[model samples]
Target chain A: MKAALRNPVDFSQFPDANGHFDRYGGRFVAETLMEALHELNEAWRDCRNDPEFLAELDADLAHYVGRPSPLYYAERWSRQLGGARIYLKREDLNHTGAHKINNTVGQALLAKRMGKTRLIAETGAGQHGVASATVAARLGMECVVYMGAEDIQRQALNVYRMRLLGATVQPVTSGSRTLKDALNEALRDWVANVDNTFYMIGTVAGPHPYPLMVREFQAVIGREAREQMLSEYNVLPDALVACVGGGSNAIGLFHPFLNDSEVAIYGVEAAGSGIDTGRHAATLCAGQPGVLHGNRTYLLNDEHGQITETHSVSAGLDYPGVGPEHAWLKDIGRAQYVAITDDEALQGFHDLTRAEGIIPALESSHALAYVTKLAPTMRPDQSIVVNLSGRGDKDIYTVAALEGIQL
Target chain B: MNRITHRFQELRRAGRKVLIPYITAGDPHPELTVPMLHALVAAGADIIELGVPFSDPMADGPVIQKACERALAQGMTPRRVLELVREFRQIDAQTPLVLMGYLNPIERMGHAAFVAAARDAGVDGVLTVDLPPEEAAEPIELMSAAGIAPIFLVAPTSSVERIRRTAQLAQGYLYYVSLKGVTGSAALNVAEVAEKLATIRACTDLPLGVGFGIKDPPTAAAVARIADAVVVGSALVAKMHELADDPERMRREVAAQLAAMRQAMDQAGMPTAFAG
Candidate 1:
């Protein structure tokens, strides 16, 4: 893979004109709630510069969510995949068992700072719901989560965890009874309660400030990995890889390294069956440009502009669209988007579990699947850092059922 | 004849149920779209609703979404769909054709350009999903100038004031969304739709068409009893998907479904002369 196109925009300028990421992101929300989003953006901009805010977040991450998770060298997996040396950033070991808590905690603290009393969120695989609930309890705020009716059934245990954490989980039955429906319901709720409530969006998706904010909180992953690789290998990795479902984890691991001209950023999408089968969630690799969830991004929509169904082995990555930032990154050649089929992801899953003793979430398995392709071509001295976004505990049952291996 | 007004008056005078079959213009295959329109008319379609595939249809269900996907995968475009309509006009000039879709494609094509192109293509009306009657004044004026009826939707959740406003702005038949959810959702309350239709009747004299849940012949026939027209979408779209590999089979099955609805509605009353 070649080097990524340099991102011309500087982070120091913060919230570029029209709130865009090089003409990709902006406030494309409903008119009734523009003031609310604007207020949020202003508050976030102030907080980013405040040392007190950053210090509080750093303390919470250290004592509450357990930051500085280990960087594991997957020696066995590297040999098996015949790839360049593979290193895993252990975000999956973070509190709440996924990278979602990283953003949720940061946003919850911001919500408290903004004097908001209630917090609301939308979840797809229930990971974000659990993370939000966990943080709301810690912050002593009222939390409400909207989930698709279908996801509620599929992830019943996480739904129970959310309830146990003193959060209200509302099931959305609109649209396809999936993530998009939950998002629509959450948006309706946000519009209705914009004055008193804070919407803690789970991923680097949504209208504007959200994608940028979530990415900022997640940038820690890349910063730590870059520093660790420099100390351990005495050189920059040839490539950075992460799974892209709404692109939170990917953006987290990609942003800090955007200025690194020598590093290649690869966003691996979940191709449930295959791209040709029309059942995959590889939006940028196979889809066209369209507006979805208030963002002008690439979506798997039909000619009539109706959103199509998407499938993936990982419930978390099964959405039909990717984040708008990812779309823009691909357009500018800042990143290369590829897809890993369900079978290949499964192979990656089993290989990681057996070789590295790390049972990765199906979502993270997408990145592992990409390494299997990129490793054999690289020189032995080259390095690839994979953001292990989440653990496999929540996905064990799903993977077992697919493999006909009863737990 | 002013086909739209004449058709509405004819259905009014006869007290017969109108059969409006919706088909995406380039669905399954673009080359087969015009022939499918002719086949549908031959199988007893009174009005043809040609869906112009846009990139986003917020109100449609999964079945119609898939149909749009197949058409788009085959490289179907709005211009290609209009070309199909122009070809359909060559054989059946009198049957009313309505281009149903969202505002973006029309906006992207430019409202003035769309009206001009549609008028030239022999289109009689349009039903843009997102364009409320409140925001429809300018586009309605543009369409009306081209002699194209600007059809509008009246939902059951709509307040009486909104319904009255919608009725006043709507040109052809009023489209009454049969349920509270998007297109293809289950749980249709025909009684609720009928009551809403009656409320709308107090505001305007236009014919009302009930859609969004008319899936089968029985449901279509039931809706036809109270409303002037029944719009069947998901059932027909599902048929297209089931037969996407075979265009001839898709056309036959779709035409058969429309013919079944037509036959069921025909039993309610007989055709009468055009009152206009």
Candidate 2:
């Protein structure tokens, strides 16, 4: 059943000229980075319309990055839930085993066109670090990744992988010694090296151009999913679900479908202990609007506006601030956001592995966890699509240690 | 006139350069901040930058970052920083005070509320590190209405167009980041900074204050030769950290360090008029 409806909100008009999404996103960086951001905005605008640039980006995505990943029907898992048919958007099958590569590949291309010889990024769970290193290696550009010291110790395998890919993994020991700290360190590095360096931000956050640019690069996911649903299944999914930290993957899947008024959108956040316990990374769920990093967004800060520490079993979801679009989306009532506890997410991970023989990343497991709750509330005739954003190969050691097995 | 403008005018008339020293508010100890500020004023600091410690200071290097952490750990908040300002104003009303930090704390307090409170606390100017002139229309308007000057940073990478734009909105003095990095970064190249200052001078008549990497007497002296003011930060902050155990020594030593820079800058004479 197709519904022909005109969307009240036009998605493209967002960030309106100055990169603001209804007062959520703006360039909040220092003056040192202003002209550089302006230049990046200009370059992105130019390349966005250039056929040659599109051709090159398309060629690389098709051949090197492997786009148009398949949409898989999780029949067994859907039957087990017993309420709605479930489909998984297989972003985990892409190169680098996650949705992170989609943005890094595009940004690396843009950096190359801008005549940048170096790429710098900040990573939490190391997926983006690996993706950034992979693109930098392919493009023959020097790469540096700022990772929190705590994360570097936990995700040592990805640290080695990035080093093997010829990227320097700089450990940040400031602030909470986590993703937020890494972002601060990365911004410092960018400020110091703005001339020859391009900051390849890993998410749909930061100041202008970055959130908009990263969203545009990632929108390929929703575009493909929409076309695939119409052509193969003949009906759009009743619900869309994805995990959000800085929200690149979730935004990628949600953007194309935003104009579809009938579609229900859900963004899941990581609730380490619980929301009431104050140890969660659920920024939109439990945060006030404040400025941080480079934009005005909902942030987990105290009464005095100091960024608070966040905890999550999954490193990627442990952030105090979310992408500004998510904050805007939540405020506008266009999308719904919920939280999944670590225990529940772990259960979802095991349930998906056992039921469908799919080893999902812990970050993606949050989305799957929500689907287990939402799918059971809907009719079995309708379908729900959850973005399996990455594979769990990197999490084997973590799961093993939790299960009392030495990997 | 606003105290900042008055101070700059007074210095200009005196053919002397302004020496601005920055210290994190409530650093070392909350009780010692007012004393430290008084000591700085006694040391010939024409204007002072009082740092409101935010947990994340992206524009600052490790030295100031640690200072912020220390301050935050001691329960320093934006309101408390204002209270400190009020205390400092009680004794020394003439030495203009500028609260410098990132924007979140002020944003936490509504812009109007923050501006009104700042005006009440006798804050002469505000320099939000991450806030440029482009996204600052509302705050700039609010601060201007409250009779408080809105200070802005002009970086080495700032374009001529940007300089003109910032110069239009800015009051008090424009803080010129002497290098291409965060506060307390590498040494500044004087010729490079001088050339940039000339470009900036072409845009407006706002008095210029140079900061970032003006570590000691010699560097401050070098900067005083080319700019209207020499603003020193990390050197004093690092000095404070060294004497954190002794608040009396911390105040005296930090003041002595600033006094040395002031002496050196005074010996350098008034900066040669911008060649623009």
Leading candidate by TM-score: 2
- For residue B240, model 2's alpha carbon misses the true position, in angstroms, by 0.8
Across A1-407, the per-residue lDDT of candidate 1 in tens digits comes to 23223545444454464555664555544333455776888899899889999999999888888987777888887887675899999999999899999999999999999999999999988999999999999889999999989889878878999999999999976567788777767776775566779999988887768888998998888888888988877888899999998999999999888778679999999888999998888888888776566555787766545677788878788787777788878987879999999999999998899998889998999999888899888977788999999998888888888879998
Q: Pull out the clashing pairs in model 2.
A: none
Name model 1 segments beyond 4 Å from true: A1-15, B1-276
Off by over 4 Å in 2: A1-6, B270-276
* C-alpha lDDT of all candidate models, in order: 0.82, 0.93
**Cα displacement (Å) at residue A355, model 1:** 0.7
Candidate 1, residue A213: lDDT: 90
lDDT value, candidate 2, whole model: 0.93
Candidate 2 TM-score for chain A? 0.98
